[model samples]
Every structure is written in structure tokens, then in C-alpha cells.
Target: MAALMIQGCGSDVGKSVLVAGLCRLFTNRGYRVRPFKPQNMSNNAAVTEPDEQGRRGEIGRAQALQAMACRTPLSVHMNPVLLKPQSDVGAQLIVRGQIEASYQAMAYQTRKATLLDLVLDSFRRLEEEADLVLVEGAGSPAEINLRQGDIANMGFALAAQVPVVLVGDIDRGHVIAALVGAKAVLEAEDAGAIRGFIINKFRGDPELFDQGRREIVSRTGWPDMGLVPWLAAARSLPAEDAVVLRGAADGMRQRVRIAVPILRHIANFDDFDPLQAEPDVDLIYVAPGQPLPADSDLVILPGSKATLSDLAFIRAQGWDIDLKAHVRRGGCVLGICGGFQILGRTVADPDGIEGRAGSALGLGLLEIDTILGGDKVLEPCRGRIVDGQAVYEGFEMHIGRTTGEALNRPLLIREDGSGDGAVSADGRVSGCYVHRLFDAGTARAALLAKLGGASEGVDHRVAVDLALDEIAAVLETQLDIAALARLAGLKDIPT
Candidate 1:
């Protein structure tokens, strides 16, 4: 019956990282612990663990990290509402472990009460089963405007009667102001629910806060948990969002270098995880500030929730200019999902399905036009590269329908007529809706040749499972497990 909520002073203030730390902390103590976020507005999400009845829910990466910390099977009930960005003002809503529908912020706000009902239902289920549920709040509850349908923070706190531990990022200059403002922003009733506070990501000496800590406790009347310094290896946790999942390619090949054009809304970029399993290849992320390396063996344009918008940004950065030059120089390019959409001639959002103003131009690399399709395609795929340069199979999730004369040039072939990706003639560049091409041995080998990535002898799944277990082990090492049991109020139960 013990539950604690973690709410941040603001977005990207390390709330996700804090829950990840606590997940390990509580799990090490031998108590069963889980993570919860009543509603999460993130494109990053995890496929839930199957229950006895084989049920599935839409838990975000935060919960996945917690489950990994506990070394437990992930559960669907951990997150009840998952909102994936489809456009600037619109989101695709997933409630109680399933896709509900896409809605604009205005429409979503109107249905906030209904969303809260779903959140409460998920919490009740977790309360019935787990020893601890560490809930994570989205954005800030201090924004009184959104609190009306607020299942994410204070509203959930009040409904579940869960104790909260507000976390402030000292790395940000507004730590004191954020803490004080939080106390002032909430109604007295909501503010009283915060039982304690923690300062995260401190760089200097911990004692520097000796005086500051006292002042905060005196001002907010909340106890101090601890000022936690940054954990350098925090990246070991399973990445719920693909953007945070990259590491240098582990290939042993000395000459291999790959450039990844970091899409603004990259989704499931974890498909590249095994590339990091090798020891030889160097992985470099190509962001807005830098140009794609012409000398690099390959360039990758990853998936995106908003392909058209990202395409515009890519053009703004003049990356499209660089991409054309890289292609002419014989450097290979790979596109996935929205990346696939962008490679086409144009992207049409006739219905404003993706929340953009209207139809938009694409990167015009692949000779195709992608129409925004209402039906979302989600399925694991398998394929064979008919041509010499490419072949792989993975999952596909997108809202665009691509049409092209060259679309029939499949990179891989399965027993089924179509598998995952398609290849064009000459095969210098190719595209797919799949996320993890590195997962396939044949595929990886082919791509390594193009990207100069080195390969490991291990199968992709074995490597992935090993990496996941390794991350889970970190939770055991850093967390105060026994302390968590006491905090969860489950210290007396038989292990």
C-alpha cells in the first residue's frame, strides 16, 4: 500500500532520470517496485509486459527503465495514457494500454476528466498488485491552467493520496525559485502533499548546500531526501525514447565512421543499439550545427513523428544540400519511417492529419510522395535484400502511404511477397519503415559495408537481451533497496 509520486519543477528537469534512479534504489532492496505515469506526452513508449491473461498496455520508457531496474517483466498498467506527437498541436492518444485516437490539445483538454478516470483505473490495478509504484508527473503541476484535467501531477496525488517527492535540478539556475514557486503555485491543499524534496544533478561539493538546504526546508516545510550527484553511467538504463539510446558503434574496424542526422522527433532510434555493440566503428550524431561528413561511409536519417516538419528543419539546416552532396560522393544514406517519408518527392497532409498547415515538400531523394494516411501501420517485419547493397527486417509504425515506381525494389524478401524495406535501382541509397535494421545479421553486414560499421559475431537479440540485463544490474548497484522497502512500507513482507 505504499506509493510515492515524483513531480519535477519543469520539463526535462530530470524527472525521468530521477524515477530511473529510484527504480534501481527500490529494486535493490528486494521489494517489488514499478513506475507509473498517469499520462505521458511523449513519442517514446515501451511495449508492455504480457500479463497472465496476455494483456498489453502502453507504458513509456520511464516505466521500462524501472522494470529493468527491478529486473522484472514490464507491465502495461505502469502507464495508462501515452500521447505521441503527430504534429505541433496534435497528439496520438493511447489509453489503458491501447491506441485510443489522435486529438488536438484543445480536444484533449476537453476530455481531461475522462482521461483522469483512465489514469485512476490503472493506478488501482497497480495498487492491487505491486509492492511499490513510483509515479512520475509530466511537465509541471504549477501551471494551474492545465490542472483541471490533471491526472499527471497534483490531481493524481490528491486522488491516490500518494506522497510526493519534488525534484529540482540544481544544474538549472532556477532551483530555489522553482522550489519556492512550486510551493506558492499550488493551492495549499495540493502543496501539503509534497512530503520531501531532492536536489538532482549537482556538480560541486554536496556541502555547498548546507545552508541552502536548511532554508528550503524552512521555507517549504518539506523534508530533504538527499542531493544526488549525476550518475555518469545513467545511460545504462533501457531507453524508452530512441533519441537517448545512442552510443559509439562497438565495431572493431578502425576505418568505419557513420553519420546519423538526428531528426528532431526521432522515434525508436534504439534500432541502432547493436551498432554500439561492436568495438571498431565510430558512431557520430549529425545535429543541426554540423554537416554530414562526406568522407564518412554512410549517413542515416532516422524515424520521426513529424516527417514534414522535420524535413523543413533539415532543409533549414542545409542538411538537404549536404545529403545530396554525400549521395553524389557515393556515401550511402539510409532512411526509416518518417525518414522514409522525407526521402520522397512530397508529403501531403491534406486533412491536416499530421497537424501541419498543409501539404509540404519532402527531401525529394527517393522519387515518392507520401500521403498522410489515417490508418497507422504497426507490425514486425521481415525482408530480404534482392540487390547487393542492402537487406533487413524490423518493425514499422507510421501514418504515411508511400507510392513510387521504384517501391517494388525490396531490400529483403520473406515468405510473404513484401517484407520490410524497399531498394531502388543501383542501390546506393534505400529506405524502410522498419526501425532496427542492425538486428539482422545479413542486414547489419550489408549496412556495415556501406556505413563502415564493424560487426559483432553475436545475434542481435542476444546482444539486446544482454544489454538490457546489464542495465538492470546497474539498478541493483546504485539503489538503496532496503531503504526503498522501508519507504514503500513493505519491509515486513517475506521475500
Candidate 2:
């Protein structure tokens, strides 16, 4: 029952990617490994199996990918507490993959203490199943303001008795100070839990940073695990944050321009990563105040953590007006999950699942109405394109049940004899609850063909696997893999 926790100096410091790469590295060495995060604050979720009574669960997308890296099935225990932000001050709480409650920041802070036991219970269950458990911590343990009820960082490490390896992002600059300052500020018990530190995303020669590394080791008394170089292969993997949306529009010379609006509460925007990788596609994530490109071939409304709120937000940004003009100009429109709910005639939140209990008028692009109050549908599904034979695989994670005339012209026909989503009569507008809808090669090609763009059609799943292998190969050379294994108390190391 060996475990190692990867905490970071700050958010987006590559803790998730490091844990994922290590998971693959150890699994390749014939060790049974599992990835766990006691708490995750992200809307990029993955759907998993239904419970005995036919209810499904959701976990963060990073954990889902790490599960793949470990060659294991996805489980809710991989991420026990998920916080999906509905607004700047509030988020929906999920416990062990089930929707628990939605709370404001202060309210959640007070409530998190109650959930720590559940988080450790899940960690214990995972420990019983795997030889090595790679745990990823959320935010930074140095966040003293958040240390009181902190199930996300050092608190969880101390409670679970897992050794911690602090990761600092060199690409973000001030790596030395960030690492040292963390050690300086943390309470002694929390600071003592840190066993080592790793500098990630280094650009230049490693030898140049020798003095800097020494400074950190001398100051913090933590050994250097490795200085991980920037992994370009990580670009192929799905990003877990909307911050990646900033530069996603750059380096686009492709003929077909697919524009997606960056919603404030955007979730599962990684649905477009495969499109971004396509040679013939220019995927532009339209920022706020930036209108959807009028000449673009397609405008996709991506999933949102808060459907009604984001729908209103897009309207405020006047994107709805741009979408109408784009539709009139013959540009295609596609909506996924929450985005799909917004394409309908109306969205009703009678039970206030998203926010205040009320009905909001939708974009009216599809002849449907959505009632947003129900057990969230969370399941992986396989289906064929409604008007085409191309098969596609994706998962659904939404709380709305849609009903209307447009449903008669569903966008997909599930293998289970069920239908999903809807398509407009002219075929220019469509919507579906599926995320990762573009991961299938044939389906991606067929969808691009509708916009008159040629697609070489790379299977996204295959691309992810190759990227994982590439990362593992790099970490094998750069990182002290044997030292890490020993740190995790792995006794029978594969040569």
C-alpha cells in the first residue's frame, strides 16, 4: 500500500500531467498503478458506468485519462470530490461522483471538512486495489487561507499519510522562489510531509539550472526528483482548463475555420482538441467581446458548467446575434451537452439545478425545450451519425432532458436503439449531448465533409495513447524513475 501525492506550487503547474505520465511509466514497468485526486475543482468531467439502479457518475477528465494511462477502468474513487463552478462565487459539489450540493465559496469552505472522511475512504479503497497510487493535489498547499478545511492539498496528504512531491512550473517563471516560499509558509507538519520537489517545463539546458536546483534543495531540504522538459506531446492530450483556450486559435492556416465561444463556465472544451490537431482545420476559441468569425464554416457551442447562466452570458456578449447571422449565411452550427440545451427554444430550471428556478429562452436554432432537473445522465455511448453511416463514440454528462419536434430528426442513432440530440430541417444546425463527439476518425471526417473540408481523420483515442507513450519515454530519461519508485516504497522494481 504505497502512495505518493503530487502537490504543486500553484494551479496549472502540470501536477495532473506529471501524475499521468508517472502512472503510465510505472504501468509500463509491470506495476499495478492507479491515479487518485482527493478533490478536483474543474468542470471537465468524464462519464462512467451506471450504478445498480441505472444512475451514472462523473469524474474529472484528467483522472479519466490517467486511468487510461494505467490501462484500468474509470472509477469515481479516482476523484472523490468534484467542484463544478456555476459562478465566480459558487460551485456544484460532487461526492464520490454523485451530485451532492451546490454551495457558495464560504459555504463550501465550511462544508469541506465534513467531506474529508469520504475522500480518505475512497483513497483507502483505491490503495487496496493498486500497487502504487499516484495522487494529484488541487491548487497549492501554500494557500494558507485555504488550509483550514483543505482536503485538496497538504491536509489530504497528512490525513492519508502519503508522501508529497512538490511540483513547480519553470515555464511560468520564479520556480526557485515558488518552491522555497511554499516551504517557508507551510506549517511544519505539512511542510515535513513533502519528500521531494520537481521542476517542470524547463526550456533550456538542465545544467544551467544546477545552481537554482541546489538553492531549492538547500532551502527546502527536499531532494530534486527531476526537471521535466516541456512535453510537446501534451498538446495532443486533452487540457483540463479553459486557460488553454487563450492561444488555441494561433497557428491556424487550415481552410476550414471552426469557431467556438469561450464561455465563462465552459466545461469539456477539450472536445475541440482533436479538431485543433487536424491539419485542414482552424479551431478558434472565440474569447469574450470577440464575435464568432462570420466566414467560419462552423460555430460550435461547447459544453458549459452552468447552462442557463452561460447562455445568458453568450447573449450578453451578443454571440447569439452573431450565431443567427452565421446561420443565415449558411454556416453550420453544432451544440454539445449544455450547449445543446441552449440551442433549443426554451430551457427550464424548475428545481434550480443551475441557478434560480426559472425558464430562459434559448437560441431557438432547434425546435426543442429542455427541462433542467433530473438525475444527470452520465454514460459512455456509441452511435452512428443520424444521416450518415459513420460510427462515433462519446459520453454524455448533463442534467437536462430535452423533448420537442426536432428530436424526431436526431443527430445520432445509438447502438442501443435509442436516439440522441437533434438536427435542423435544412441540416445546417444540430445539437447533441455527447462530449468527445469528434474523437472518432470516420465521424470527424464526415462532419468536416459537411463543411466542404477534407479531413485526414486521425483517431483521437489513438493519438492520446501515442502521446502517453511519448511522455513516458521522455520521463524515463529525464526523471529519476528508480528513485521515485523507491520513494513510493515499491520493493519489487522491474529492471
Candidate 3:
């Protein structure tokens, strides 16, 4: 078995996307490939396949997408340690697909060393079943302050004996300095782990950067793996970080305008990827301090990692008033998981699972109340719009239970005859706990038709699959795939 790790000079340097492209590139070349991330920090997560006991776990959404690139089922081992941030200073820690505990930033720094064995164990398990494992490193190895108990970057690469390739985002500028600076700051052993360096997101003619490429190699003594151009296909893929949400809403006028008020702790924002991909629909993310657009046909309340906290944030931003006004103006309103809870009359946190043990008044859009304490529900399910034939499949991953009179007018009916969400008495407001609710073409089309627009009827899953292949094809021509294979001890791959 062979493995290679992709690390970056800093965050948002495209390490995850590069590893994903490589995973598909190698998998297309007839290799059994798997993806591994020693640790990940993001609220965007996906449910993995169930085990013998019918228990499903969650992993970082990027790892889940990489698994799709490899044509493999999702597994918890793909990401051993996941930190879902609930606040600025702390996060809820997940290990081996289960909630281990919550820890503050300072406390987690000291506690990471003990999980090295589990990270390695998961990597080896993937190696046992595949010819190659594409590993992704979080943040960067140049963070010497975090080098003490790091399990994500140099620490995991050195321990797993995996060759590393450093990636720098040229589009962010200082490509040469970023690559050389990483080598300069890293300790000797950590620096030696990097086998080569790749320049990513180059936006001009390749020949224009020849001198720059040579300078990076001349300074770092690492081989120039490749200079990849700006990959337009990447825009079609789901982004796992909240940073991407900034400036995401292009203000282009279209047939339908849907506005989502960006919550402070928004989670699973990618649930709207399908809607965003539609050419006739304009999906806008209303950031803090910005008023929700009055002209929008639909106002969507997105999922949040910290419900009560973001609920309070909503009120602070005066969006709660905007929503009430929207409903009064006869505009449509739809809420997602945490947003669904927020649409209710009350949201209570009895055990303090998310933050403080308290309760907050909801928006009162739906006649429901939610209590945020319980065994999290993480399972795949199939359902259809209540009294409609637009069937769809999605998953439920939440830690609260909601109930009330609105459920009597369910928005969706599961295949098992259970109601999934609620509908308003006026039929203008609705909410559900289902993530990826719009992935199905029929489902998206049905919802858009109600908003006085027509959907192109694109299947989001199929589009993502095609996008992965498009990225792999680009990497095939722009990258040194053969050299990357050689670095991973894979010598037989055709050039």
C-alpha cells in the first residue's frame, strides 16, 4: 500500500480540493483509492454508512466528497477527529464518528496528542483495503506554536510515514514566498517530510510564472510538481468551510430570488448548493448588519451549529423583525434543521448540550417547540412533499426533538408513514429537518415551481459527480501525476 499527504502553506490554500482531484485522478487510472484526514475542523459534516448495529456516524464533508471521488462508501475512519465549532473559543469534538466531548481551543491543544494512535489506526485500516490512500492535512505545518500535539499535518505525516506535497495558492499572491516560508519555519524533520511543492490556482499563462516556479524550487530545494490553473469546475463542488460563504451571494437578478440570512454559527450551508446551481435562481446570503432583501420571493432560514446562540444573534441583527415583515408581506419562508427549530415558538436547552442551559423564544412562524438535548439523530431517509409526488432522499443529523400543532399539517411524509416537518396554516411557511433536501431534480423543480419559477431540473448529485471528473481531467493535464505516484511509492502508473 502507498500513501501521500497534501499540506498547504496556510488555511484556504486549496489542500482539500487538490487531494480530492488527485483521488479521482488516481481512481480513474484503475487504482483502488481511499481518502484519509487525520483531523478536521468544520461544522459541515456528512453521515457515513451504518454498521452492523445500524448506527451511522458523521465525518467531515470534504472527506465524504473525496470518498465520492474514489467511488467508495462513506466511512468514519476517513476523518478520525472532527471539531465542530459552536463558539469562537470552543468546539464539540468528535472521534471515530461519535461525540467524544467538547473542549476549548487551549484545552484541545494539550489533548490532541493522545489521539495520534487512533488517527494512525484509521489510516492503516484504509491502507489495508486500498492500493493508495490520499491524505489531506488541515491548516499548515508552519504553525510551530501548534506543532506540540498536532495530529493534522507534519505530526501525522511523520508518524504515518507518508510522503508530503506542499500546495500554495498562487491566486492569493506570494506563491514563492509562501512555499519557501513554510520550509523556513518548519523544523528540520518536518521540512524533510515534504517531497515536492505544487502551485495551485494560478490564473495566467503558465509560461508567465516560469521564473516564479524556479524561484520556489531554488529556495526550498523541493521539486516543482506542477502549476495548476484556476479550476472553474471547483465552483460546482461543495465547499466545507464557512469562509466561502462570504461574498458567495452574487446579486444577479434572476427569475426567482431566495435570500438566506447568514447566521453566526451556520452549519451545513451547502444544503442550498442545488438551488444555487440553478441558472434561473439567485441565492443570496444576507450577512450580519445587512437587511434581508425586501424583493426576495423566498426567505430561507439555514441550519446552525449553535441554535440558541444564533437565534439570539438573529434577533440582535434585527432579522427576526425582517422575517416577521416578510411573512406579513405574503412572502414564503422555509427553515432547515436548526433554522427549523428557530421557526418554532420556543427552543429550550435543558442540559446545555450546545451552550448554556437556558431557553430562547423562537420566531413563531410554525406552531412547534424544540428541546435541544438528546441522542443525535443521524440517519438516511426517503420522503415526499406532503400530499405531493415529488419524492426525495436525504439525511437527518440533529440533537433536538420538535413537536406541536403545525406537525398536523406536515410538510413531508416519510416512507415509513412518519411526518418529518411542519407546514403553516396559511401554506406559506414550512420547515424540515432534512439536509440535502434539494438534491433531487424533481424535488428542486417542485419547490421552484411553487415560487413562480421554472427549474432546469438538474440532479445536484449527478452534477457533482461530473464536476469531480472534470477536475480530474484538468489535473491530468496540468499536474505531474506520474511524479506524484512515484513519490507515494507507486511506480507502475502509466504516464
Candidate 4:
């Protein structure tokens, strides 16, 4: 029944990575641990098992990775409220892993109050099943402006009665002020919930920050948990936010240039992590106003939370023109999930499932037409590239059902005797609903070969595990694990 919540001074402060590392560290000590986030605002989601009602749910990708770190099965309750942004002012609300509704920013502010009970119910269920529940808070609790209906940070901590550890990112600078400022602004009850503070992503010697650490402890009366050094292994992990998408394409030495447009509502962009690790590949994330590199060997349209909107966004950016030109130049094109939907001749959303009820013209690269409705497909799949013998495995998470003449030339044949994706007659264009399509060793190599590049043929899943282990090892040496265990109220400690 013990729980500890990791809240941060601001967004992108590495709270997720810290929780994940701690989860792995404690699990390695033979403790049953689980990761939970009462609310998450991100489009990077992972599909989990079906609930009691037989409906599959989706959680934030970070929680799914933390579940792997804890060696536990992922549950929708791990992340009860997910906000998938569809536009600057609106997002689709997901309650217990199923789409609930879409609301504008101001509308959601009033609506979130009603969902706090649901968040707590999920937390209690998870608490019942584990020895230690590690909770990750979204954004800063210091936003007293957001304190009224806040289920994401201090509000959830106080409601769930979980002790909080405030994490500050030193790499972003002003670590001392950020930590102290949080204490200064938070209401007494919320401020008192924080038991300690941990400074993360420190670059230089920890000793140099002794005075700064002492200043924070003296000003806030919260003990210094530890100052964690920079963890390079975190780079190998899938990024859960688009903030990391910047500068990803800079300074590449690889021969094969593969470009991906950074959509406004990009979902599950982690599918390219495997390609990013390839030595012979240069994975460029093309931002708005930046044309898809003409010298690129391939252009990939990544998954998006809002297909029609992003399709419009690409057209507005003139990327569609760039893509057509790239195709004419013999460059290969691949689309995943929402991206796959856009490659077809037309996409119909009669029910307004994604947005306004309407049909949008697609890129017409594939002879398919997609109807955007139906229960979202959420399941693991195993198959092989139809054009080659390379085997692959990944998960499908999309709401569109596609059918057309292009079905006769599918990109992949699932093990379940089903075909999943369309391929062009000339074999230069392909699209599929599968995410993590490049994680399999043989499949990655085969795909690269088709684009005239050689792959080292490494299994991405194993690489991710090794990276987690490495981070856990670093945490073991840097953090006060015994103190953290005691803070978490672990009755028994393993040697």
C-alpha cells in the first residue's frame, strides 16, 4: 500500500525517465513494482490488454516502457486519463483507454474535475496489486492557476495520499530557482506533500552543486534525495514528446537519408527509433517549412493523432508536393497508421470520429480508400514483409479501416492469414497501420536493403532492454536507493 509520486518543476524535466529507471532498480531488488500516471497529455500511446468489459485500452508510451522495466503486465488503469492533442486548442479525451470526447482547452479545464474520481479508482486498483506504486505527475504542480481541477500533479498526490518527490532538471539551467520557486508558489497542503527533491541531468561534478543543494534544502526544508548525472542511455529510449523532435536531423554522416515529416499531432513517432540507431541511416525529422530532403532515399509519413488535420497541415506546408516529386524521382515512400490513411485516394470520416464529418483527398500514392470509424484496432501482430522473407512483429493502433484494389499487393502478410498494408505496383510506395515496424532485426535490414543501404541487423527490442539495464545500473550507483526504498515504505529490503 506504499506509493511515491514523482512530480517535476516543469515539463520535459526527465520525470518519466527517472521513474522508469527507479522501477527497474526496485524490480531488480525483487520488489513487485508498478508505474502509474493518473493523467497523461501526449499522443505517444501504447495499446494494452482488454479490460473486464473486453475492450482493449491504450496508455502513454512511457507507462508501457515503465511496465517493461518493472517486468509487469501493462494495464489501462496505469494511465486512466489520456489527452491526445488534436489541435493547439483542443484534444481528444480518453478515459480508461477508450475515447471519451474531444474538448477545447477551456472546456477541458472545467471537465477534468469530473474525472478525478476515475483517476483515483484506477490508482487504488493498481495499489492493491503491487508492493510499490511509482506515480509520475504531469507538468508542474506550481501552476497554482491549474490547481483547481488538477488531476495531473499535486492534486492527485493529495487525493491519493502518495508522498511526492520533486524532480528538477539541472541540464535546463536554473535548477535552484525552479525547485525553490515551486515551494514558494504551491499552497501549503500541496507543498507539504513533497517529501524530498532530486536534481536530475547534472553535467559536471556533483560536489560543485553542494552549495546549491544546501540552499534548496535550507529554503524548502526538503532533504536532498540525490543529484543524478546525465544518462546517455536515455537517448536509446523512445521519446514521448515532440519537443525531442527538434535537432534530430542535424549533422548526419550516413549514406541513406530517410526523412519523416513532423506532424503537428504526430502519434507513436517512436517507430523510427530503430532507424535512428542504424549506423548506415540518416533519419531526418522534417519540420514545418522544411521541404522533405530531395536527396533522401526515402520519405516516411509517420502516424498522427489527427489524420485529416495533419493531412491538411502537410498540404499547407507544401510537403505533399515535395512527396509527389520525391516519388517521381524514384525515392521510396512509406506511411504508418494515420500516415497510411493519408496515402490512399480518399479518407472518409462520416461520423466525425476524428474531426468534422467530411472526406479529405489523400495523396493517391496507393489505390486505397479509408473509412475512419469502427472500434480502434488494438492488437499485437506478427508477419513478414510481402516483398521479402524478413519476419517482423509490431502492434496496430488506429481507428481507420482501409480497402481497395491496392489490397492485392499488400506490404505485409500477418501470421493470422490476414494482409495488413498496401504496396504500389512499382514497389516504391507502401503504407501500413503498424507502429514499431522497424524494431525487428531482419525486417529493418531488409527494408534498408530495398532502399540501397546496409543494416547492422540488431534487434531493437533487445537494445531497449540493454539500455534500461544500463540506466538501472547507473541509478544503483548514483541514487540513494536504500533511502528511496525506505521512503517508499518497503518493509523488506533485498540485498
Q: Please report, in order, the local distance difference test score of every candidate based on alpha carbons.
A: 0.71, 0.90, 0.92, 0.91
- What's the CA RMSD for each of the models? 4.5, 1.3, 0.9, 1.1
Q: Please report how far candidate 2 places residue 403 from its true position, in Å.
A: 1.1
Candidate 2 per-residue lDDT over residues 292-333, each given as its tens digit:
887899999999988889989999999999999999998899
Question: Which candidate leads in lDDT?
Answer: 3
Q: Which stretches of candidate 2 lie over 4 Å from their true place?
A: 50-55
Clashing pairs in 3: none
TM-score of 3: 0.99
Measured by TM-score, the strongest candidate is 3
- What is the C-alpha lDDT profile of model 1 across 65-168, one tens digit per residue? 66665567767678877888776678878776566777888999887677777688778887777778888998888888888878889999999888887888
When sorted by TM-score, best at the front, the candidate numbers are: 3, 4, 2, 1
The candidate, 1 or 4, that scores higher on TM-score is 4
Ten-residue region with minimum lDDT total, candidate 3: 49-58
Residue 431 alpha-carbon offset, candidate 1, angstroms: 1.9
lDDT of 2 at 468: 96
lDDT of 3 by residue, 432-463 (tens): 99999999998999999999998888789899
TM-score of each: 0.81, 0.98, 0.99, 0.98
What's the residue-level lDDT of 124 in candidate 4?
93
Better candidate number, 1 or 3, judged by lDDT: 3
